[model samples]
Target: MTTNDEARGEHDAPSSRDPQDTDADEYRTTDQHEATSPIDRRDYLRTVGAVGVLGVMGGLAGSATGSAAAQADWETEADRRIAEHRQGSLEVEVVDETGQPVPNADVDVEMAEHDYGFGYVLSANLLLNETEPGHPYRETLKEDFNIVWFGNYHKWRFFEENQEIADQATAWAKDNGLDIRGHVCLWANVDAWAVPGDVVDAMGVDHQSGESGADLDPQHVRDRSFEHVREIIEHYADFEYEGTEYGSVIEEWEVMNEVVHVPGMIRAVNGVPGEQESDDLDPVTAPVLAEWYDHARDVAPEDVGLATNDYNTMEGSLEYARSAYERQIEFLAENGSLDYAGIQSHFGDRDSAVSPEETLDVLDRYAQHGVRLRVTEYDATGDDWSDEEKADFFHDYLKTVFSHDATDAFLVAGGSDAHHWRDDAPFFYEDWTPKPAYHVYQDLVFDEWWTEASGTTDDSGTYATDAFLGVHEVTITVGGESTTEQVSVTDASGTTDLVVTPGTSTSDCEEQGGVQVGEHCARDPDDDSLYEDVNGDGQTTHGDVNALFENLDSDDIQGNADAFDFDGNGRIGFSDVISLLRDI
Candidate 1:
C-alpha cells in the first residue's frame, strides 16, 4: 500500500510543515498539525485515480507498479513502526460508514465545529475591490478570504461590470486553496432597477395570462436560474478563473439565497398578491422552490455543493420554515436534487442564542433524513451588547456549533475584517484591529489541519484523508474577515502543522484543549515521553530517575519522560522509545 514517490503539487504539502511554499502556507501557519489519529502512510497517499491534478499523480503512481511489491514490503515494516510510535493522542472520534472505530485512521481537521452543509452560509462580497496586486488591502486576504453574498445580482448587473471583482476573487480562492459557495443562482424578488432586459422580456409572456405587468414568468426565472448556476460553476472550473488560463470552475454552489425571507421581503416590497399593492410576492410556492433547486443541481458541476438559505433559524414565525426545509430536503432526496443544506445563523438578535444541544438536535434530525447540514451566514448581533460581550458571544456560539455531532460545516457571513453592522454597537474600531469579537474567533479557529504523506506537495487545496473518510469540518468566514484554524494531528506520526481559514475562533480547538500543527497533529499521546511520569510521583518532574528505572520492566513503556507523559506514568517507557523513533 506504499504510495509511489511522486511529485506533489507545490501547494499540497502538509499544513505548516513547509513555510517556504506560499500557496500551502497561506491557509496554514509555519507550525501546526492535524489532530486526527495517524494512519498507514502507504494507504494515506495511495492514489488510484482522480479528476484533477491528482489524476495525473495517480498515473505517475501507476508507472511504478512494477516495483509495487518492494514498496509494499518496505511500507509493511514502516507502518508497524509508525503505529508503535503513536499510541495515545487526543482524538475527536467519528464513526465510519461501517459503524466501527477505524482507530488510527487518517482524518481531515478544522477549527470549526461542523463540516460544510445545511444551516451554514459562506458569505463574501469584498472580492470586488481587492483584485489589484499592489492594493494595500491585498495582503489582508491571507488565504481563503473572499466576499460572496446572497444578493449580488442587484449590485453587479452581470459579468461585464463585475468581471474584475469576480476574476480576482476566483483567482485568489483557487490559488489559496479556498472554496467559495456560489450564492443564489436565482432569487425571486428581482430588484426592479437592476432587472436586465432579458428578464423583462421574459416577463412579458406571463403578462399575457393577466398575471400583472410586473409579474415575471416563474418558468423564465427557472430557466435563467439554471443558466446562471451552470455558467457560474463552470466559469470557476474553467482555467480562466482557476488560473488554469482556460476556463473558470467552482466546485461548490449555493443554488438560491434566503427563500424563507423572500416572502417577507416580497410582501414588504409589493404587498400580498391580489391585494391593493400586491405584485408577484405571492407567486412563489414550495413546488417552485423545489424546481429552482432541481434546476440549479442540473446546471452545477458534478462536485458542486448546492443549498437553500434562511435566517433566524432558532425561533420566530420563521421557525416554521424548518418544516419547509424538511420538505425541501425530502423533495431533493426524492428527486436527487439536494446535496447540502444551508442554515443561516444571524445571531445578534434574540434568535442567536440557540443552544448547542438544540442545534445538534436539529442537525441530527436532518442527518437522519440523509441531509448534510452547513451553517451559512452566522453572525451574532445585539443592540445592548458591548464589544467584549460581542466577542464572548461569538466565541460561545462557535463552541456550541463545533461541539455538535450532526453539523458537518459552518460559514461566517462577512468579509476580512469587515465592519460589523448592528442596531447599535461598536464592534469593529476605526483601525480594523478586531474587536474582542474578532479575537474571540482568532484564538479558536485558525491552524493547520492536514497530515504529511509520501509526495513533496502539501495539502493547500485538495480534500485529504479525513474528508475522504467523512471526517472533515468545512468552515467559511464572512464579513471580509479571516480566522485561523489550528489543526491537530490524529494519526500515528507525532508531528503537527497549522492551517488558517476564515472567521473561525482560534479557540474552537483551544476550548477542547488541543492544537494541530505539522506532521504529528494526530499522533498517539500514549507513545510520547512527555506523557510519561518518569518519577512515578503522580506529577511529572526531573527528580524521577529511579522511578523511571523502577518501571523498566512494566507494560506502560511509552512516550517522553518529562515531555511525553501527558498523563503521569513512571518510566522512560517502551512507548517513549517508540515515539522518539517515530517518522512520517
Candidate 2:
C-alpha cells in the first residue's frame, strides 16, 4: 500500500509553523478580500459582544490569538468581513394598481431562505423509509437547512442499485423547497468500495503489476466514465416524477473526488504502462483528470456548477495536500473546467485542530485561485474532546468561514450520529437529541445571521433596511389589506427594488357548512369536498391533517397560516392541527 507521505512527496510534509507566521499577503491576492467601502468596526464589535463570542472563544486557548488584543482584532476583522460581504440594502415599494404610491403602509420582511448554502449530508433511505425514528432528521433538515447532498445513495456503487430511492429523495427535496447538490459523479479512490469491481475488471489492468490485458483500451475507459457522468447529470437535470418536471433541481456536481490521493482511474486511462510502485506519485496536472472535467462540463447543464473535491486541503497541517490542491485548481482554472474548489474540511481526532485564524489563512490561500470556494464536507470529530469543546470549535469555525468572502457555501459532512460516517462527529446525538454543536449551528445560521424587519412605508411608499443577502418575503399591508412578494437580495451594495400592489379582502367562495380558506371554501371532512385537501389527495381525508401536522413548523404552513387556521386562531400552532383532527 502507498503511504500518504510517499504519495505526496518527502519535502511536502505537513507544516509545523504557527498560524500567526502565515501571512495572507504571502499568497496571491484578490479584490474579494479587500473591503469595498469603509465598515463600522464598532458596530461589528458590538454585534459580536451581543452574540457572546467571548464565551465561544473561552475554551480555545490554543487559538491563533496569543493576547486579548489579538483575539479582539480577529473578531473585529471577521465581523467586518461579514458586514462587507454578506449584507445588502433591501428597498420595497408599495403602490396601488393604478401606479399611485400607498403611503403609510405596513411592511414586514422575513427571510425565506439564504442564497448562501448551509447544508448537511442526508440519508435517502432513512429519509423516505424511516418514519417516527427519522422525524427529527427530516423536520430538522426541512426547518433548519436549505441544502443537502445524499450521503451514499448518489455514489456510483449505491446509485446503481438504488436509483429509484435516490430519485424519490430528489423529488421529496424539491417538494420541500430544498436545494440539492450532486455529491459526486465519480470517486477516483482506488479502494474497491469506491470504484465498482466491474469497472476495475473492465480496465483489465492489475493495479499491483501495472500490467494491461488485451482488453486494455484507454478510449473505452474514458467512454464508460463519460457515459456514467452523462447519465447521472442529464437524468437529474430534468428529473420527472408523477407528471411534475423538477427542472435542474441539482445545481452542482462534484466531477471528481480525491484525485490527488488516489489516481487509479488516471493510471487506468494512461494504459497502465509500468510496474505500480507504492511510492510513485502522479503528475499534479494530470491530463486525464482535465479531460474528465471537460466531458462533465459538456454533459451538465449550463447553469450547473462543476467542482473538484478533495480532503486535507483546509486542515492547516498537510502541506502536501494544500500544494496538490492548489496545483489541481490552477490546472483546472486555466482549462476553464473548474467552478468551485471543494474543501473537505474534515478535522479528524488525530489531526491537529486548526484555529479560526489559521482557517482564514487557508481560505485566503485558496481564494486567490479565483474559483468559488465551498466547505463541502466539514466535521470536527475529536473523540477525546468534551461536548463544550466541540461546540466552541463549531461556533468559532462556522463564523470564520461564513465571514470569508470567497466561500460560497458551508456544509457539514453529517448532522446526526445515527447517519454519520464517524460516530463522534455529528451535531446531534444518536437519539436525534441536539448536542451543543447543534445549538451553535442554529444560533449562527438562523438567529444571528438571519434577517427579519418591519416598518411603515413613508411618503414615497417605501420601506428600506439593510439585510443579509438571501431571498426574503416582503408583505405590504395597507389598512387591513395585505400582499406578499418574494425578493432576491444578491449583491452587497446592490438594491433589490420590489413593487407590490396592496391586495383587498374578498369572500367570493360559496360556504357549505365550512370555513372560507383563502379564495376557496373548505367544507367539513364528512362532505368529502375537494377544497382544503392539504395533501392534494383529490379530497379531504385524515391524511390531510397528518400532512399539516408534519409540516406545522415549515415555511409553507406558517406563510399561509390564515388559510389553514382550522381552529380559528390568529396564528399557526399545534392547536390548529388538533382542531382539524377532531373535525375529521
Candidate 3:
C-alpha cells in the first residue's frame, strides 16, 4: 500500500525526501534548484492525452516509449493519487414509499457538486452594481464555482465603509447555493491601505516601513486587533438579511493574511526593540502570531474555520518565508488554534512557475504540520505566452492541486480579466467570454471529475459505484414511473439509502411541457406571447426584453437553449434576444 508521501514521491527522487530525514535547508531546497519553465503547449496536450486527468478506469495505452513512457507513468501516478484521495464508493439502495426493496429498478446518478472547493475571487461592486455585465458575471460565478471570497470588500478598510455590500453579496451567494469564505478579519500590515488610517495613526507605526514609534503601545494594538476580529467574525456568524440568517453560508475566515510577508502586527505585539529594516529582517517567535488565532477562535463559531494565509511559501524561492510560515503552522497546531494553513500561489512569468512535482513536494513538507491546506489565492501571469499556453499551464496546475490529499480547496484569484488585479491573468475576457483556460476549468470540474453512473438494481434494489465525493441527484425508474432524490456521498464507507414514490419527482416544467426561465418555469411553451415573458411577469413588455438583454450570455439562457434559441441556430445569442425584443 502506497502512502501519501510515497505517492507524492513517485514522480522524482527530489520530492521523495522526507523532511524528518533531512535538515531544514536540505528539505527546503530539495527541488528548488530545478529550472522550472512554462509548460509546452504540445507537451501538455500530449501528457493529458496519454493519461486522462483522473485515470479512474484505464491503463497506459502503449508500453515502453522512452520520454513518452515516463510522462505517461507520471500522469498515471498523479491520477491514482487523485482517485485514491478525491473519490469514494457510493451505494444507492432504492426502496418504495412503503419501505420495501424495489426490484430491477433503473437507477441513474449524476453529480450535483464537488465536496472539494473550486472557487475564485469576486468583486462585490461588480456582483451588486453593474447590470450590463453583472448579470453574466453572477450567472457564471454561480455555474462555475461553489465558493467565493471578496476581492477587496471584505478588507478592513473597505468593509468599514460598505458593510452593506458584503452583506448583500453574502445574501446573494446564499440564495444561489454558493458558499462564502471570508477573506480576512485582520491583515497584519499596518499600512493605511490594509487598516483604517485612524487605526494606523493610533498604532503609532510607520505606514511605509512598519517601524514602531515612541507612542507604540503593545496592549493598545492587541486590543484594536482583537476588537476587529471579534466584530468581523460575530457579524458574519449570524448575518441577517431580509428575514433570513445567511451568515452561516460563510464557512471559513482568514484570521490574518500575509503574516510572514507583512509582520507588522507580530512586531507590534512583540515589542521588537529595533527599527526593522525589512519585514523579514527579524524573525519573531511563532507564539506571538499564534495568539492572534487564539483570540479569533474565542469569538468565531465552532464550525467556522480560522486560517493563517500567506504567500511566497509555496511558489517563490523565499526560504526564510517558507521556514517562517512552517514555524507559525507548527505553533498554531500545537496550540490547537489553526484550522487551515493557506498557501497563496501567485505565479508570474514562465520561469517562476512551480512544476507539478515541486508543488507536491511543497505540499508534503507543509502537510507534516498537521493542518488542513488550501490554495487561497492562485493566479498565473505571463506577458509573453499566448492564451493557449496560459490555459495549458492552468490545466496542469489545477490538476496537480486537486490530486493532493492534504489540499482541500483551490481558489483562483480572479475569473475575468476586467476584474483581476493583473491584466490577462484570468479565465475569461473583459466581455465575460470564455478563454481557453475557462473551457479547461469546465472540462475538468464538470466533466472529468464529475460522476455519472447508471445501472439496474438487483433483487435487493441496490446499485453501487465509485463516485467523486459530493452531492449527487439519483433518479430511479420502476414500473414506468420515475422518482429522483438528492443524496450526499460524503465518504467511502457511507451508503446513502433513498426511498422514493414514483411520479413524485417530476418537475413543474416536465408536467407542463414548459422550460425553465431564470428561477421560474415557463407555463406555456406553445403560447408565443407567453414565451416572451422572459422575466416571468404576466405580460410581454419591454422589461422582458431588458431581462433577456441583461442575461444574453448567461448560463440561465444558454442552458435553456431549446426555448431561447429563437434564431434557429440551436444556441442562445444576441440575435435571439433581438428577436424577443422585436416581438415584444
Candidate 4:
C-alpha cells in the first residue's frame, strides 16, 4: 500500500490515476478565491489586463487626473527628474557601427542589462511554415546572438530531439556567436498539463470545455501537477547527449509564465446548445504554481537559470501599471520562488501610452524589494500598425527599454508567423524579407549591443552570477567606458574586487572561492523528499507521501530519485516503503 512497500518488492497495482500524472493540480485551473469583494473584483476587471482610454482616469486617480496622455507625460517627467539625480550611474550608451558613441543615447538600466536574450517559438502550435533556405522564420535575426529562448514546450518534446534543434540554432548563433535562454519550465497556461490515463478515458477525446459537471478533485490535480513538473524539468536538463556537455541544450529557463493576481477565471465547462459561459480563471493558483515552480527548480540543473515572467509595460494603460504595482510585488514575495523576474514588453498601439519614464517607475517599484528583473517576452501589438509605424514603434520601444534601470535582460519575440488572429504584421513579408523593424532591431538592438567577446561568459556584458554567497559580475561605467569584471562578495567580505577573464563565456568564469554546490545538477536524494508536501504545510506527514505514491507505477522515479525515492537510493526501495507506510 505504501511507496516503501511498492519499492521494497511488494508491488501494488496501479490506481485509477495514471502512473505518469503524479501531480494533478497543474491540469485543473480552478478559481480558488478566499475573499469575496464584489466592488474590488469589478474594479480589477476594469483597470487590469488591457486598460481602455477612460480606464486611465481610474488608474491614475490616486496620483493625477485627466487624460491618459497627461498621466504618461507626468510619469515620464518624474522619471527624468529622478534619473537626473541618479544620472550617469545606471545609464550606459551603446556604440554605433562607426565605433562612435550614439551621443543622445538614453538607456534603461533594467532593459539593457538584466539577463537579456531572445528566442523563437519552436512548437507545432506556433511555428513558421517550412520553406526554402531551411525554416523560413530563421532569417528574422542576424548571426551571433547571445541568447536563444526556445519559444514553447510543444516544440521541445524530448531532450535529444530538441537538443538537435538547439545545437543547430546554437551553432547558427555561435557562427554569428549567440547565447541560449530557455523560455519556460512550468506555466499555468499554454495548455501544457500532465493528464492521467483515467481522466482522459473518463472524459473521452476533445477535453476542452466539454466535461460539464465533472467535479474535479484538488488532491488529484495536485498529484498530477507534481509529476508533470518533476518530469519536464529533469527530462530536459539531465538528459545527456553524446557530444555536447551535460545540460548544454537549455542554459536558462522561464519558471512560471505570466502569473496574474486576478481571481475571475474558469477551467472546465460544458455549454448547452445556445448557452455558454467562460470558465473563470483560478484565484488561489499562485501557491500551487509556486510549489510546482519550486519543485521544478529543485530538480533543475544548477547552471540553468529559472525565471518568473509577466508583462513589464502594461499596454500603455495607466490602470495596467497601477494594478501591476499594487499587487505584482506582493504576489511575487508571497509566491516568488524564482531566480529571475520575467517582464513581458508587449507594447500596444496607443497614442497616450505610458512613456518610458512611467515604465521605469513601475519597474523600480519592484526592484526596491531586491528582486532581479528580466524583460522576458517583448513584442508590440495594437490596432492598425503599419510597417513604418512598426519600425518607429520598435525604435521608441527599444529606446524606452534600454533607458530603464529596472530591466536586467530583454527577450525580443521572433517567429515566422504573427498569427493574423493577433495581428497582420507579417513576421516576414511575402518575399521572406525581414520588416524594417527587424533591420532596426539588428542594427540598433543587436549589432550595437552584441560584441564578439560578449558571448563568452567572461565578457563584461554577461551576468556571471547573482550575489548568492560569494563573487558576482559587476559592471563599472567609468567615463563612459563600461566593463564587466568579477567582484568578491560575502556576508563577511562584502564586495571586493575579483579578476574577470575577458573573452570568455559566463560558464568559463571561475567559481570564485565560495559555496559551489549543485551548480548544474538536479536534486539529489537529500532534498527530494522535501517536495512531497504538496500543500506546503511543512510536515512530511501522511498527505505528502500519499500525493507522491499516487503515480508510483508511472516510472516517475527514473529521472527523479530525490523526489520519488524517500530512501535516497537510485531505486525506490524499502526506505521509500517505510516512509510511505503510514500514508497507506
Q: Candidate 3, 26: how far from true, in Å? A: 35
> Candidate 3: what lDDT?
0.63
**Angstrom error at residue 538, model 3:** 40
- Clashes in each model (backbone N, CA, C under 3 Å)? 163, 0, 0, 63
**lDDT tens digits, residues 409-518, model 2?**
99876535544555554566666566767767766766678787999999988889988887676778877867665566777978767766676233322322434333
**Poorly placed runs, candidate 1 (over 4 Å):** 1-140, 143-161, 191-219, 239-243, 246-248, 263-285, 315-318, 350-352, 416-427, 447-584
- What is the RMSD of candidate 3? 14.4
Q: What local distance difference test score does each model get?
A: 0.38, 0.65, 0.63, 0.39
Q: Write down the worst ten-residue block by lDDT for model 4.
A: 2-11
Instruction: Residues 1-584, candidate 3: write the lDDT tens digits.
Output: 12111111001123333322221110121111112232232344455542453342123232212245555666687788888888888666776646577778898988877889998776666566543333556666777788887766677766776777778777777656567888878774442255665555445565532224345566767788788888888897666677553334467888887766566666666664222444443433446566778888888877888887876777645576678888878877888987888887766555546667777888888889888898887766667556665666666678888989888899876635555555454576665565766657766777778888999887887788888887676777888776655555566445434444444322644465545554433334346533565543233544455456556677767776776765566666555654564454
lDDT of 3 at 350: 52
Total clashes for model 2: 0
Give the lDDT of residue 346 in candidate 3.
66
Candidate 4 C-alpha lDDT tens digits along 381-421: 45555554555445445555555555545666544223221
Deviating ranges (above 4 Å) for candidate 2: 1-68, 96-100, 132-134, 190-192, 202-220, 273-283, 504-584
Q: For model 2, which pairs clash? A: none
The sequence of per-residue lDDT tens digits that candidate 1 reaches over residues 1-584 is: 00111100001233223212211110211122112222221232243111322232223322211254643554354334323432113223322223333232233333321112212112123333323343222333332233323324222133424555556555554443344566545443332122243543344322221224545344554466456655655565543533234232344566655454444223323323211234433323445556656666665545666766655444222445566666656666677777777676555444335543455567666667676666766665555444454454454455445544445565664422332232121223333333454444433332212222211112222223321111223222334342322232333344222232232232542342322221112122344424333322122222122233234344433322344432234444333322221211
Query: How do all the candidates rank in terms of lDDT, highest first?
Result: 2, 3, 4, 1
Candidate 3 lDDT score at position 380: 66
TM match of model 1 to true structure:
0.50
Model 3 spans with C-alpha error above 4 angstroms:
1-70, 96-100, 132-134, 190-192, 206-215, 272-275, 278-286, 493-495, 499-584
Locate the minimum summed-lDDT window of 10 residues in model 3. 1-10
Model 3 pairs in collision: none
> How does residue 405 of candidate 4 score in lDDT?
53
